[model samples]
Target: MLSQPNYREIKSSYLITKEAIELAKLQDIDTKKYKELLKSALEQVLDALGISFDEIRGIKKMDAFF
Candidate 1:
């Protein structure tokens, strides 16, 4: 199981990456492929950490994009 600090780090990184993808999309940088790749990677990490997307998204302090 991942520790709280590790989980927060991963989650924060994912959020920042997600924001970057959005910026890329706005710039018309072909983010479709990148978004798919990011989702797959994040899903794998969440699975490995025994975390759920719902749980992450449900955090009141954060505004998760997806």
Candidate 2:
């Protein structure tokens, strides 16, 4: 089970990722390239979190984490 602080940390990390992507877009990053980069990075994070894409939909509380 994740502690409250750990949950918050993950949320914050995701927020930063979102912001970075937005900033890249604002600076004219290509959507196709960005998505490719994001997919790779997200895969790594999901693996580190022990959260598989298949399990995401099964865990209601974790649905928004991805």
Candidate 3:
């Protein structure tokens, strides 16, 4: 398990990547790379938390994060 601070930091990084994806979309730039990165980061975090992707449905902004 990750320490509380480490977990928070990881989650922050994931959110930053999510924001980058949105910004890229707004700029009409291809967001494929950013989306892939966000997905990978999210998968890792979910694994760390022992949570399934399905468990977060409707709780998080799926389009932004996935």
Candidate 4:
């Protein structure tokens, strides 16, 4: 589902995933804030990447992270 191009499906999946994580938090299954942040960030990245192909035009020069 993460690799899917359909925007509504992507959003639905994202919401479902986010809800599950939030429920887990309430249950004390995984309480680390950083873990939730990381998960949310990855979901955002997946959604952004899924939508970006249409707007992309050219290559981006790569640089090493410091």
Q: Per-prediction RMSD in angstroms?
A: 19.9, 19.1, 17.9, 18.3
State the lDDT at 12 in candidate 3: 35
Report the lDDT tens digits of candidate 3 across residue range 1-66. Answer: 566754653333333435554355566655898777777779889989987665675565476677
Q: Sorted on lDDT, highest at the top, how do the candidates line up? A: 3, 1, 2, 4
Positional deviation of 27 in candidate 3, in angstroms?
5.6
Selected candidate, larger lDDT, 2 vs 3: 3
Write the residue-wise lDDT of candidate 2 on 12-45 in tens digits: 4333334454355555657799777877777788
The runs of at least 3 residues in candidate 4 whose Cα sits more than 4 Å from the true structure, single-residue gaps closed, are 1-31, 51-66
The residue-level lDDT of candidate 4 at 9 comes to 50
Determine the C-alpha RMSD for candidate 1 after optimal superposition of all C-alphas: 19.9
lDDT of 1 by residue, 1-66 (tens): 566764653434333335554355566666799877777778889999988655776654355554
Off by over 4 Å in 2: 1-29, 53-66
Q: List the residue pairs that clash in candidate 1.
A: none
lDDT of 4 at 31: 56
The parts of candidate 1 lying over 4 Å away from their true place are: 1-28, 54-66
lDDT (CA) for every model shown? 0.66, 0.64, 0.67, 0.52
